[model samples]
Target: MREFVVQQNQSHSVLITGSTSGIGLAIAHCFARAGHHVMLHGLADNETADALRAAFAGYPGNQGFSSADIASEAGCAQLVADTREAIGNPSILINNAGIQHTAAAHEFPSDKWHQILSINLSASFFLCRELLPAMRAARWGRIINVASVHGLVASENKSAYCAAKHGLVGLTKVLALENADHNITANAICPGWVETPLIQPQIEHIAREQQIDLETARAELVGAKQPMARATSPDAIGELALYLCGDFAGTITGAALPVDGGWSAQ
Candidate 1:
């Protein structure tokens, strides 16, 4: 595991969608550890939300949580407004909420397709649309989208996910260009085979369908595209996110960075 050192002096209010768990939660913690106020948004019960809030109590900056459905424009707008009221305008936004459905394109359910696109792609647009003004007014902001390797390569059964992630990458580029002079940077992080709750069901299904043990199924899945033969850690993604929001990365914008364990090399 690589060590992450938090820079001591700088801080910003950050809002991360789908931050109750998985990669989003990890990113939220990264910002909080850096002394930034973090507003977490996700679908979680009151108990889980409270636990997440309590987990951040040790951080220097304020921490807030919201259980808003971000799959629609109204929900995304309300989330931004609530975050601003709770912790001030977020100078950083991480669009990490996503849903996945797998099937042949012809066999994919229409409703599932729409749901995936709405949450994975449209929500990012809505959040960006609503939050960009604040960042522009302030003259400084960071927008990081958590895309997937599927954004760059085709997979057999992930049409909606791939399309949404690809769209997100494109959106990131446009935002970066439009905001270049405003001291705001937009980028996408493409990760491969990360161990998160989102991927657990797939892993189990692979095990059951292939009639293999869990470890074998895991190995086969990771080996199919990832040369590292392991899932990328959420913390690794979080650390990269933190780095991108720092002064050192001010000039790096509109880049689709692949932290994919060499999967893209293929």
Candidate 2:
């Protein structure tokens, strides 16, 4: 890890999508702190993401913004264009923008289903489609998709989320194979539960739906899992992405690396 940290070059441009908060923000800070140029993007307010960008202006490398919602084609195009303009074509792309909607499979609203797929699945694909040309021309890149333990196994609720993450794994594999000739690698990180804003709403809804104390509900959800029995931290993800983009992981691609604390190991 120290060698990896020391190897960080300030010149590398890393584009981290959906980086306004949660795992995305953590990754952004990780790369920045590690001395890489970072371009952060998300379905964020123009002013807010820009404010965050401004805060990083004093950092050693370039910091930038992409305010467009990544779920739409136009938004994705804008993101690619803005990212290219800000830094160069990203040598590292952490496809971390995602959303989750929980409901019984039968009661899942149609709009929610579409929304989840658009943001979590389709957007990731489009971002890759738009950026791959540059990466291929460079002959090296890392595409790290933030997937979930749900991609490996099922939960009672979160049908649409599972579908999208499961698809992400498949997508990662295909992208890896397709870009192998260019030395561009694609991989998925299947995290169990993380204490991100994305999960808070589900926690609140679960607490209300089950009529349990929030703390108790949280424990119940976590206790059901194995090993460390707690959610992974966002910084942990940041560190992982940092490593995946490093030269040490040059040979690792198309692998669904589970950063889940042994949850999917069961």
Best lDDT among the predictions, by candidate number: 1
Taking the tens digit of each residue's C-alpha lDDT, what string does model 1 give over 1-266? 01112422357889999898899999988889888999998999999988988899999999888888888889998999899998998889999999888999999999999999999999999999999998898778899999989877778899999999999999999999999998789999999999887777777899999899988888888888889888988999999999999767888999999988899889
Prediction 1 TM-score vs. true: 0.93
The window of 10 residues in a row where model 2 has the poorest summed lDDT is 1-10
The C-alpha lDDT values of all candidates are 0.89, 0.84
Which segments of candidate 1 are over 4 A away from where they belong? 1-9, 204-213
Tens digit per residue, CA lDDT, model 2, 23-81: 98999999998778899886667688668988788778888887877778888889888
Give me the displacement of residue 24 in model 1, in angstroms: 0.5
Evaluate model 1: give its lDDT. 0.89
In angstroms, give how far residue 136 of model 2 lies from its true place.
1.1
